[model samples]
Target: MAGTVRKKMSRFNSMISLDEVSRIVKAYSWKKLSTVEVETATSVGMIAANTVVATKDFPPNPRSLVDGYAIRSAETEGSSPADPSRFKIVGKSEAGKGFYSAVSGGESVEIYTGGILPEGLDAVVMAENATVSGDTITVSSSVKAWENVASRGEDLSAGTVLVSSGNIIKPWHLPALTDGGIDRLTVFSPMRVAVLNTGDELFPDAPDHIENSGMSSMMALLPWRFSNTLWIGQVHDDPDDIARAVKESSDRWDLAIITGGSSLGRKDEVPEAMGIAGAIEVFGGMRTKPGRTTSLYSLDGKPVLSLSGFPSTSILMADLIVEILLEAITGVSGYRIRERLPISSDITTGSGYTRLIPGTLVEMNGRTMVAPASSNRGMRLGSLLNSSGIIIVPEWVEGYHSGDLVEFRLW
Candidate 1:
């Protein structure tokens, strides 16, 4: 049955628009990965598999927000600097140690920051605003009900959802989760990806070629952003060798990426080799500049993305495709940070295709502006090295003029 499905899909050679490709990528069904419980300290960068709920109120009781006196609001009413109201300080309430007695109408409890507000006390007066003498406090300032006091459940109520499922755990989320009584979290295991570099002219050891290879930079970029990626090394531009390398790696890894030989040249056998390896081509090409030859395939249940060999094109295509894959697998979106900044100069694009141009953001005359990086060839590595982000020119829009606002994806 699977073989028949593959055979039918093999005839699908149509080029898809970028929007259609994005939709197809979003609709893909991802295989479930195993989940593991880890300490909150170690869970940063992992996707949460379960929502975390607050076990109790954040403060668990009404607490003082300042070092002062906890008293009934009426006790401080009609008090002034010239004619102050007097209250007998019966006891003190320090943090973690609550006063056993209730505060009466003429009484107040000396309370420190984080100290629990005693029963019948609805306000607090800062110590600086009161005069303390012997066992009595004279308050000249009147406080309203619940003033300077944090009520129970003010920060987070018991049973409240602190963190939603499918969220990528960040460093700032740890303290809140910890305060809500969450010590451990269940998160999806990081996806394992295999990268294959296919080309006949490529040398693994040649310093210049290796430095210029997209595979080398992608190898560093992938593990940092999306998954545990391993470069299975390069294969000669032979259909059979490429097929074997892809098939073997796809079986062991969650996804496979083939860089180089993705274009339509005679030596560009990746798309054909993907079929020979029992993979179904989902899309052959995209209507996008610098990466029009980008292709996606499905081997068994795993996805295999074939990207352009050019460094600039390969980087842009990987960012787009891998983000979709990450969202599908983890139920969380990658590339979360996007900024809209004004273009520093006029930019043009082809009429029928989307254009992705590398850009560097700078402050000019006290305003943030993005300028396109210079590169005569799309294959050059200089543009990518100097760029902090990429400008996305939509398919319908021809271009943008200077001072036009454009959306950019930061690196």
Candidate 2:
């Protein structure tokens, strides 16, 4: 499958970069599709529309923070635990219930936790702390006004940025929306994407056995991070078959990715198949190491990235290029590469390529260190399984050793 397309093509661009590939693949960039109305409670795990606001102040009313007796400040004066003060409880208040009467100097209102503060009452004394006799609750000690009252809008105001645009909704956010008095919101609707893998040999690796087919995981991770994803399965290495697949699949999806057959191969028909479907081949290579086979093109503005078949190459390409397209298409930015530091080590860089060395990051003395996962590319999973992240060795830099300061990416 190597060099078949390049060998036959009349011309191929001599220079290509990862940035160019990203721009091409992200052509249409997050075309908004139809949105469905969802209940605020059920909308958990969905996206947020513009900023959200509290329709009414959270708690909406001043409520008691504890089960206690509500009373006026002047009435509780000259009270102590030993010489307790007694008062007449005019009425009782429970959660969701409110007392409306204004209290006189010697009277008190019975208030429970979450109960609305009675009218003209300023403070509350705990039920256990006060002694109740007849309709009166004794004041065990002097109380201050507003001491046990939850003020209106204390949790949230009528208007606030509950959530902003471009945020992937989490389950906890739903309660905020509910508290904010939002029944429904205009969230960035889920992005539907098609994962079109092309190759006779590009089979999904055995669950127990891993392969460079990591592209599938890499591709799937994009939608997982942003919106909806559909695995369209693999197409035989036939131009007509591929073209037909692209046209048919494009109807149901917002973005389409054709992996595996992007490069030069006797059976590599993806580029031509895309061309046959009237799609533009933006570029077909990158300057990055472990991913020279990375390519990008688009059909009717939808994104399509071609990743190398090697696991290391596909994973790196997906994290960098495919992830970029996902962000562009869904208006979502994927997680950044995090770092930890371990031991410091240096590597020799070959003259031509920009190398991405697999490494573990560990933090020591508040500084991060980068240790090589391995010099070998095929055993990436070994490093990935226990990795901190890649220790990026620039194009021209030679390497480093122990005690050398290196950047880290946390896993």
Q: Per-model C-alpha lDDT, please?
A: 0.80, 0.67
Q: 1-411, model 1: which lDDT tens digit per residue?
A: 666445434433466777898788878776666688899888888888888898887888899999999889987787899878899999999998999875667899999999999998998999998899999999887789999999988988879887787788888889778878889989887777788887766765644444436676677665452367788878877878989988776656887888887765555577679869988877788878878778888887688889877776787788778877777767775445678999999877757787788899999989999998855455356788888888888889988999999988888
In candidate 2, position 229 carries an lDDT of 77
RMSD of each: 4.6, 4.9
Q: In model 2, which regions exceed 4 Å deviation?
A: 1-30, 74-91, 126-143, 202-226, 238-240, 263-269, 333-375, 387-411
Cα lDDT tens digits, model 2, 189-288, are 6667677766666545534433436545755655342467787767666778778887878877776766676554455566678778887766766666
| Candidate that would win on TM-score | 1
Measured by lDDT, the strongest candidate is 1
**Which segments of model 1 are wrong by more than 4 Å?**
1-13, 101-105, 204-212, 223-226
Cα lDDT, model 1, residue 115? 96
Error of 1 at 180 (Å): 2.1
lDDT, candidate 2, equals 0.67
TM-score per candidate:
0.89, 0.76
